[model samples]
Target: MDASLEIRPAAAADAEAVAALLTDFNGEPVDGPTAARRLAALQGIETVLLALRDGAAVGLCSLRVVPFLSADHPYAEVTELYVAPEHRRQGIARRLMREAEALARAQGAPSVYLLTGFQNETAQAFYRSIGYGDYALAMRRRLI
Candidate 1:
């Protein structure tokens, strides 16, 4: 981590930057209002960890805590993780993941999981390097 870089929880004021980062992740534009609403909706059960460099948001990781019928404690799912193209390979993503995991632990979550596109080999390698292993296949259904 850079000495000037800081990682902290996202705030209402971060709507624009967060939205921009999310847009990068989704490969689409996200308007400010929509991003604000999404962030507000995740206020309680989820957390967005932001990495700032010189007071600018550079990266983010969103974590959601959920209950599981088979577990004594709730588990956490990492819904999103992104870093600016200019900031890649700087350990920002790893730092954000660590912070998100720490928050999940503080919330009594027993484990944390995440999913990435099958074609994203770089992401898969990174996750594996960080000790994350595949436990099961992820299936999804689109209702729209």
Candidate 2:
């Protein structure tokens, strides 16, 4: 399965594939139309990559370039990452992350940032293994 899996940047035509992966990862329905709209918007400035195996989407990762902490250190943020349950632990996420990092470096980004919720310990460990660390102090204001 790993040998046949191909990972590459997403296109508008990949909307359904990407949406399906997201839905599976989240255990809920993600609007396909919304995914398509967002994919269209990423036509240039951002990147959304998909992993396909046997012509079916198995994973995906979303990345965006943004200003970093300093003027000389623009970086990429991995906004989302997901691998189908059947495909987990096979290094697909790692590959997606590596691809994102490679593109970010080429575009002059010095780092990549990701946010994982408190209970996602596995994800935290994965990020740590890939050299990511806790840095931000998150704060929020209720809008209600």
Candidate 3:
């Protein structure tokens, strides 16, 4: 990570920058209000960590803590992780994951998990390098 980079929780004031980064993550243009709404909706159970460089948001990670009936404690899942293309390779993503894990533990989650698309070879490699392994298949159904 760069010496000047700062990592912190996303605040309502950061909605615009955070939304812009999220737009990059989704490969679409996200308007400010829509992004602000989504961020507002994630107020409690989800934590969005922002990596800032020189006061601009350059990266973000979203972790969700949820209760699990099958487990003795709540678990956390990394739902989104993205670093600006220009900021890649500087260890920002790793720092974000580390912070997310710490936050999860502090929130009483025993473990944190994430899923990278099988086709995202780069992400898979990164996850493996960081000690994540195959666990189980994630199946989903589209209700819409």
Candidate 4:
């Protein structure tokens, strides 16, 4: 880990930085006000781990722990993980994953799950390198 790197849970005050990071990751603009409101609304229900280097936002990972009666423990879902293009391959994402797993452990979750595009070979390789396997395909149905 870099001495200047910090991995911490995000708060309402971080919305703009998070939004800026998201925009860089997604190539789309995200409204700061809306993101702030959503982040506030999702408080307690979600965990948005932010990675900062020298106090500048460098990456983020968003996760949620969910309970299901069929399981002995809750499962964690990491919805998004991103590192700025300039910040990639510096182990920032790995650090984020470690923190996410730590959050899962603290939340009584036995596993962490996430979805990546099937065609995203780079991400697939990265996940595989980190001890994650392709267990199931994710299918979505839009109701809108």
lDDT of 3 by residue, 26-130 (tens): 888887888789889998889999999898899999999988888878889999999999999999999999999999999889878999897999999998889
Q: Tell me the spans in candidate 4 whose CA falls farther than 4 Å from its real position.
A: none
TM-score of each: 0.96, 0.88, 0.95, 0.96
- Across 1-144, the per-residue lDDT of candidate 4 in tens digits comes to 499999999988898998998888889998788779878887776899999999998999998887878898887899999999999999999999999999999999988899999899999999999999988888989999
> How would you encode candidate 2's per-residue C-alpha lDDT over 1-144 as one tens digit per residue?
368889899988888887787788787887778789988887666899888888888899989986656677677888889998888898999999999999889888877878898788999999899888999966679999
Candidate 1 ranges beyond 4 A from true positions? none
Give the TM-score (vs. native) of candidate 1: 0.96
lDDT of 1 at 81: 94
Poorest 10 consecutive residues by lDDT, candidate 1: 30-39
lDDT of 1 at 102: 92
- Give the CA lDDT, 0 to 100, for residue 26 in model 1: 88
Model 1: how far residue 129 lies from native, Å? 0.5
Model 3 clash tally, residue pairs: 0
State the C-alpha lDDT per candidate.
0.91, 0.85, 0.91, 0.91
Q: Report the Cα RMSD per candidate.
A: 1.0, 2.1, 1.1, 1.0
